[model samples]
Target: MDQSFSGSIRWAGDNSKCLDVQGGSPLVGAHVGLWACRADHPNQQFAWTEGDGRIRWLTYPSLCLTAAAPGLPIQLDLCDSPTAPFDAAAHGTKAICTSEGVCMTVQDTEAALMLMMLGLGSCFLMMTPLSAFWRVTAAADAHDARLGRRLGWEQPGLMLMMLVFLAMVLMDINFCPHLGREQLQLMLMMLGVLVIVMLLMMPLMMLMMFVFHGALGVNGCG
Candidate 1:
C-alpha cells in the first residue's frame, strides 16, 4: 500500500459513519455503504487514496473500490488491470479533471447530480403543460393578459427561473474549490429540498384555491 490510514473511511458528506461492505462480506463485488463505525469491524477499515484517489480496503488491499459504470453501485474489485478506465463519469462523477484526480465516491457524486438533473427535468415538463393550458383555455373574465408570449412558445416567468437556476449550477463549479464536501453537500440538500417543496406546493395551492372557492362560492356568496 502506498499510504495506509488506520481510521475507517468516513463519507465526505457525512462524517458520522464509515464506509462499509454490505453484510461484512469480503467477496468480490460486494456493495458498499455508510455504516456506523466499530473498532472490530474489518469492513470499515480502509486506506486513504491520498496518492491516487483509489480507496483500498485494509483487509484486502487487492480489492479497490470501483464503479463499473455511471449510476451503478460501487463495488470492490482487483486493481490489477493497468488499462482500467478510472474515468470520472464511469465512476458516476459530476465531472473529473486529470489535474484534480477523483473527488468523491461514485454513488455520492452520482446521486447529487441525478437529483439536480431530475429537478430540472421536472421544471421543464411542467412548463409545457402550463403553456398549453394557458393558450387553449380562455380566461376572458380575468383582468391580467400577460401570458409570457414569445415568438412561438410561452412561459417566460418559469423559463427565467430555470435559467437562473442553471446559472447557479454552472457558477458552482467555480465556487467548489473554496468549499469543503460537507458544506457543498448541505447546500445541495437545501437547494433540492427548496425546489421539491416549491413544486409540491403548486398542487397544494391549487387544492386550497378550489376548496376556498367551493366553501364561499367564486363570487364570495353562499
Candidate 2:
C-alpha cells in the first residue's frame, strides 16, 4: 500500500515545533514536524497506521503518542516521536481522504467554510453597532455649547479597535483545521468576548442613533 498525502503543517505552539496531521496519509507510524516555509526537513516525515479501527502515528517503535483527549484542552506535544496518533474512532469519525491531504473531504471543506463565514459575520455585526455608538458620541461631545461645537474625534482609539477587529476577521478566515485544542479554545474565547460586547452595545447604539438623528434634524432647520 504505497500512498502519500500532502497537507499544510499546523503547529501546536508558537515555535512551529509540533504539527497535527489534520488530513493526510493514514500511515500510523510516521514521524512529523514543520520544516522551513520551503525547506525540507526529515523531522517533517510521518507514518500513519490503522489499528482497532483507529489511525495513529508512530515515530519510534518503542514510543506511543497521544493527542489531547476530546473536549479536554491540552497543549499538543511538540517533541518529535513523542507519541502516536490517537484512535480516530475515539474522536468521532474519520474524514475521507483527498489528494490535498488525508481525511479532508469535500463536505468537510464546505462545513469549515460555513463556520468561518458565521464567525466572520458575527464579528462584522459586532463592529457595526460599536461604530454607530462612536459616531453619535463624537457628535454629542462636539455639540456641547462650552466646547465650541467641535467634534470630539478620538482617531487613535478608533484606529486601534478597528485594527483589532480586522485582525480577528483575518484569524477567522485563516483558521487551521489541524489546530490543537488549546488554540481552538482561545480563538473561540476571543470570539465569545466580541459577541458579548456587541450584543450589549446594540440597544445603546440604536438609542444614540435616534438622538443624533433628532439633533441633526433640529440643526438643519435652524
Candidates' C-alpha lDDT: 0.42, 0.29
lDDT of 1 by residue, 80-166 (tens): 633122322111102221121322232344332210111112223233222112111112312222323221223333346446654
lDDT of 2 by residue, 124-194 (tens): 22232111110111112322212111112232233354466557445543554454576556545655554
The list of candidate 2 runs beyond 4 A from truth reads 1-40, 52-61, 71-222
- State each candidate's clash count: 0, 17
Using alpha carbons, what is the TM-score of model 2?
A: 0.21
Question: Per-candidate TM vs. native?
Answer: 0.38, 0.21
Candidate 2's displacement at residue 195, Å, is: 30
